[model samples]
Target: MAVARRRHREPHFVDVALRHRFLRHAHRDVQRRRIPLPIRHPGGPQVKLLYDWLTKEQGKDVVVTREPGGAPIAERIRHILLDPQNKGMDPKTEALLYAAGRAQHVSDTVRPALERDAVVICDRYIDSSLAYQGLARGLGEDDVLHLNEWATDELLPDLVILLHLEAERGLERLEGDPDRMESEDVSFHRKVGEAYVHLAREYPSRFAVVDASGTKEQVHTQVRAAVLPFLAPDRVET
Candidate 1:
């Protein structure tokens, strides 16, 4: 049964029926779908945390994880990559390391969950590398995309939600000493933002742009609206 949110015109008969069907068999009807929130903005972690809570409220039977550290092997790679001490890391090396972690994550964590018919909600994925290294670090977009293809065997998220805000505002939201990527200059992050926007435009079907400057609740509302249409097969007029 198809489902849609009730609106001012009142729930359609199909909507009512689908909701009834869902309520009657909520535990059994959950389908496997990948939902990745690309934390492109500095304020995005808060949005991601809030959305995990929102997941429970939605009863979508989704499992949440983060890139570079979702699985055991990937976590080790994460430590190496995120270590601030690794300041001298080369761009090509950084791209390869990210792919290595992602490959492990897909094989050991993400793919398995999806096979089990569970929705896997990830905090970040290939796009992060594409924005950080491919565009910002001059690693070449095609090369980065090819690297990721080898890593995940061309696996793509069902939906990519980009939390977008201006670079300076996002930087202001940071706390303490910044990490390697975070420590980059404002112009670097501005380029990263442009890269993200480019990806959104380049892949509109898979990308949803959400304003990240709003309060947590406001952002979450937009997040839900962006994904709900994809989640429910029913025709959503809005």
Candidate 2:
């Protein structure tokens, strides 16, 4: 498994490319298995990358945009979460927003992609909520899990790639400007990292941790190595 660390300040284009490669490969592998290819939602620090990649690399035709007041329900929830007024919202309400967004994302974006045989590489998924809201927001695991179940009807990813990075290194990679959650203190980021580690340990079969301390290419190499197995029948040669 690959584990890469990341900070809110770093540019996300590299990470976006890595995620796209991983999803494209995984989609092909699943097709080989004669099963429906699963979609990927790049969550956490790489969310914005989803928009850029879809528009530039994947083409607007293949990607459905989720703008505010757009057809996608997830976009609305995203708007709510990113709003500064959300800071004082209760944990349950926050969890509900995430769930609402996930539901819309899956039904609107993911389901259509599956129908068209297109690989859906999402910017973020339910895991972000589990980590940010469930763990960081101090909601108990049970509550978080329950909300997740309610939101996605218990649908989980076939594979979850957790980019593992040291808090200090991740922060350093950040370009100084951070979003609401990204701007959180180092201590909170540490907790988020710890939560991801715990998840990897808890679900080894589904989780892959990629080391993210190296240069972008180096980290991409590690990520590609981790994803190679899911890409083909033979284990990744690397």
Candidate 3:
């Protein structure tokens, strides 16, 4: 389910989603801010606290949603992708599944909310595929990118906040048994990290790289600072 707030003008803002080394925790909201919130990849801590903080700060009606599983059909697909029991899944198949889930996710959740002029804060989006399947899984970034772009009707985030952390450190931070993605060898994660860095460099205007090594409060502060300029009091749509 998603949290939504109503507005008059057509929704025209970016979304937020984080790609934890394994757990993809993200959200998407639309407002005059017009910029997607920050994101963190694996090794980076969960951004649930940040999501809660944003929900409160954004006020009562803001919509919060996640990718690959925001809607029922998409969620089912998420399970198939993340379930460790489904070992030895083909890399291309994994990428295709992600695209399929995203298609349903957009159709059922994201587009509707955006049409209602709601702020949509999502957990994960295209970047996860770009890193995991594109680079790490050797599927090729362009192909995955094109696939997802088509899947979501070419919708793209105005800003992507990346919570940067070392792959090894992110793995160390895990508390419980890792999921299928998390269980992958360190080399795979390192590739993910590298891909994120490359993406940040490639899309400097749209990517905000935040250091996740700091305390929670400190990290939140950084996230707020990065987001504030976009959602300045004067610019927010009512």
> How high is the CA lDDT of each candidate model?
0.67, 0.51, 0.67
Give a tens-digit lDDT track for model 1, residues 41-64. Answer: 754455455446545555444556
Instruction: List candidate 3 stretches off by more than 4 Å.
Output: 1-37, 42-46, 235-238
Task: Estimate, for each residue in 84-106, the C-alpha lDDT of model 3 and write its tens digit.
Answer: 88889999899999999998988
Which residue runs of candidate 2 sit more than 4 Å off their true CA positions?
1-71, 233-238
What is the C-alpha lDDT profile of model 2 across 19-135, one tens digit per residue? 221222222122111111111222233323433443454342234333121235666667777676556777778777777777676666655654554434444455667677788
Q: In terms of TM-score, how similar is model 2 to the real structure?
A: 0.67
Worst 10 residues of 3 by lDDT: 17-26
Please give the clash total of every predicted structure, in order.
0, 23, 28
Task: Please identify which of the two predictions, 2 or 3, would achieve the higher TM-score against the true structure.
Answer: 3
